[model samples]
Every structure is written in C-alpha cells, then in structure tokens.
Target: MKEGYVIRDQSLPHFLTVTIVDWVDVFSRKSYRDCVIECFEYCIKNKGMTVYSYVIMSNHIHMIVQSNEGKLSDLIRDFKKFTSKTILEKIQSEPESRREWMLERFKLATESHSRNKNFQFWQLGNHAEEIYSEKFMWSKIDYIHFNPVRAGIVSNPQDYIYSSASNYIDLKGIIDVEIVQIPVVNVLKSSSVVKYNSYEK
Candidate 1:
C-alpha cells in the first residue's frame, strides 16, 4: 500500500511542492543538485509543463507549475523516476574521490527501500498541496526563495544558483522554468478569448 495520497483538481490550476526524506541536505551536494536541474530542464523541453518558479533547498524543492498540454501527475511521476535513476547512476559512476563516502551513505539509507536495486535516490510519493488562491501561490513562492536563507546557506535568495529566485527577482532568466506570471485576465478567462474589451448595460 502506498503511504501517500494523491490530490487532483480539474477545476483549477495546480501548484506542487515536494520534500526529501528525513530532510537530508541533498541540495548541499553538487552532484545531486545538478541531477535535479538536469531533470527539470528536460521536462520543460520534452514534457508539456509550464514551470513558473522553483527553489532547491537543503532537503526539499518548491515548484509553482501547471501542465500545459499533458497530465500533471504523469509529468511529476516521470520527473521523479528519471531523476532518481540518472542521479543514482551518476553518483555511482563518477570518478570523484569525495563522492565515495557520500555514495556509501546514500546506499545505507536506500537499503530498506531498494526493491531490486543497489540504491534508491528518493523516497515514496512527494507530498503535494495544491495552490488555489493568490495569497497561497505567492506564499509558496516566497517560502521557496526563503528556504536557503532559513537554512543559513546563502545570505540572499538570489545568490542561490540552483533556484529561480534570481530570475523572479530580476525578470532576467531561468534555466528550465519560465519566469513569466499569468496575467489576471488570462487566469480569469477561458482558453479561448477574442478580446478583453467588454460592455455591460
């Protein structure tokens, strides 16, 4: 039996945040962080997801996103699967001297969860809470940027190179996700809209 439950809403746009196991400082390691970024970039280009904002914390990730032309659940699932496998392999195959101890520790943690493999990169289902309201959306965005600061890792959110904070703050650029915010009119109107001009009696 799966320990986590899935949440879905066909009525409104969705935003999801996922955390790591035991809050282990995964993002502190460059290899693991790079793997995550690789996966996210692949998804945006290949999958039909519009990733708005994202931040990589010590042990978690916050993403403001919605599927543009695909199922959100499927996209998330593939991201997790592909990242876990590729990252684990990258760690195992790397010639870096420092990675040996880190890889051993990861192996130890994955022992209980490994079904038929040597190691496991991530735990079970990622906890998700849908963002429906404007306040909630902004709150999550701020929370994502502030995660590294709260952990005492970086002084400024923009200094954290693994996040979309710099892009959001400067409106300059992002690696995988686009930083453009949906206009109020876009959110309020249906997919097909001829014009915003209107008159009422």
Candidate 2:
C-alpha cells in the first residue's frame, strides 16, 4: 500500500474507499449490498464507528468515517474481515446467477496471497485519505454523493437509496449516519475538490 493511503492518524475522520478484488461487481445484487449496510450498522452500534457520509457502488464503497474509540484501523479491519466472509457465504448459498463465476474469480484472486484460505472478497487496503481540512472533508462527501450520478445510475444524488445522500437532503436513509451540519454554501465553496476517477492512492 502507498504511504499516502495508509491510515496514519487513527483518531481522525478519513475518506475511505474499499474496492472489490479485480473490481468485480459483487455488490450489483441487492442482497450483497444489504449485507454491507448491515455490517455498517453493526459497526456503528457496537464498534464505535461514526459514518459521516457514504456511498455504496456496485464494486466499491466510499465513506467519511471516524472512530469514537480512536481505533479506526481496527474497526475497518474487523468490518472487512466479517463482510468478506459473510458476503462470500451468501454468494454460495443464496440464489445468485453468477455464483460459480463469482466464486471462481474470488478463488483465483487468493492464489497469489497465501494468507487467504479459500477466497478474497475485498482487495487489500482501504485507500484511506485523512480529512485534514473542512474543505477537503466536504469535497469528499460531495464526491461520494455524486458517484451514482456519474455512473448514470440516478439523475439525482438523493435518488440513490444505497447512499447517505438522502440523509443530507433530510430524507430518512436506509442506515443512520452522522450528518455533518455544514451550510450549503460551504459545500459549494469547497474549491479543492477531489474527483472520483482522479483518486489514485
């Protein structure tokens, strides 16, 4: 992992991206996406995680999160480990049309890494970029909310149910998030914007 992507300050909130191995569309299924939401809810309730903003795409997830317990790295590690196991099990047991294909891909992904026993669901590293300034924080939140729009999945950010964009717009989201109470003007004035595709760490 690159040094910039490393979670240097575990106590502060960071913009995090966890991509699927080989960019597989594991989360294209609603069941798989629900598993991720359940995991996030569990983390928030039991693991001291505070999700400020988030968006769940087909192959990856982005979030602005911090740990009240000041153990962001550990929280993320456990979240990934649990989600990887649970989602893999679901793919095998649930009514997935691409079960065999997905399983084979996951199996092949583990061949190079001896640490994995059967499969590798998530790709290594969280691509964590610490939120250093207010402008950067809002920029990441904007980037996250607009992901589905950029993909042509939804015309409006709040129309995406799997994202916290709805929460920002005052509608009840699928999962609870710690809404940042910044003025709309501040979000618009955040000049140092971080583009989604331009992120390389």
Candidate 3:
C-alpha cells in the first residue's frame, strides 16, 4: 500500500478521493479550486466521465465517477495533470507582493517529487473503492457529505458550499448535471430489494 491507501483496481466506476500530502488544504485557494472545476469539465466534455456525486474538501476531493469507455485511469491522469499545472502556474506567477510566501510554501512542498518539474498540487495514488451495491454507494456518499459537518466546518451538509450535499439538500449554487440518484436506506429494505442474480460482474 502506498501512503496508507490501498491502490488496487482493475475496472471502471471506482469511487475515488485524493488528498495533498499532510492534508495541507491546497484547495483553499480560489485559483486552485477552479483547477478542479476545469478538470471535471474536461473529463465530462471529452472523456465520457459521468459524474455521479462530488465533494471538494479543503485538502481532498471525493467523487463517484464512471467511464463507459473503460478509460477511467486516463481521465483521472489527465484531470490531475491539468489541475496541477494550472494551479501551480497560477500560484508561481502571482505578482502580488504579499503572495510571495505562498509561492515559497508550494515550492518547498513539491521539492521531493522528481516527476513534478515544480509544485505538485496533488499526491499520488488516490483512495478508491468499487461501489458494488446500493449500500456501498450510499455509505460512501453519506461519508463524503458528513465530513465537513463532523469537522465543524459547517453545521449542516448543505451549508458546505463546495459539495454535492447542497445540491441534494437545498439544490443550491451547483450547476445542473445528470445523476443516477440512489436512495440511502432502501438497500436495507430486503422486501423492496430486487435481486438480479441473473447478471454477472
């Protein structure tokens, strides 16, 4: 296991989340935050990456995405590459006198990775799991939304501005997108469950 995260996967539809080393909250920057948006937009537009749910935390990001073309890895790689380049370039090129310290911090943090020519905006090998059932999917989704709330960053899931919870709860500032909305508790209802044993993974 690398970085205490099990990096095993051989298929699509993997629920994925990644964090900066030491959980440094790099996403707190507005330009860095927009890098993520641009990456997702790129994947959605060109890679057939269907996003089910997402939550952008201060240091990490949780997303449930599936690629129909079996190119999930390619999509993720490009997204990370694009975001890192854009965010790092933005921080390095900021001419504001007060922002010089921030550039220093980024440069120091990324010094170890030879793969990166400069600032490494994200760490390698994201934590990911296959959503095998309704229960798994619901649990992951709930875990994501409840993160900020449990951390006391927000009182309610909907109060966190950078998450899908706001979309699920108050239908707040998120852009419209198609999603396969699954119920949280219906998986526990055995009577309501439809067993399709005829299907194969």
The model with the greater TM-score, 1 or 3, is 3
**Deviation in Å, model 3, residue 84 alpha carbon:** 0.6
User: Residue 49 lDDT in model 3?
Assistant: 80
TM-score-sorted candidate list, best first: 2, 3, 1
C-alpha lDDT of candidate 1 relative to the true structure: 0.66
Candidate 2, residue 79: lDDT: 90
Query: Scored by CA lDDT, what does every candidate get?
Result: 0.66, 0.87, 0.68
Model 2, residue 160: distance off in Å is 0.2
Q: Positional deviation of 158 in candidate 2, in angstroms? A: 0.2
**1 or 2: which has the higher TM-score?**
2
**Top model number, lDDT:** 2
Cα lDDT of model 3 by residue, 153-186, tens digit: 8877767777776666555535433344545465
Better of 1 and 2 by lDDT: 2
Per-candidate Cα RMSD to the true structure, in Å, reads: 8.1, 4.9, 6.7
- Compare candidates 2 and 3 on TM-score and give the better one: 2
TM-score of each: 0.75, 0.90, 0.77
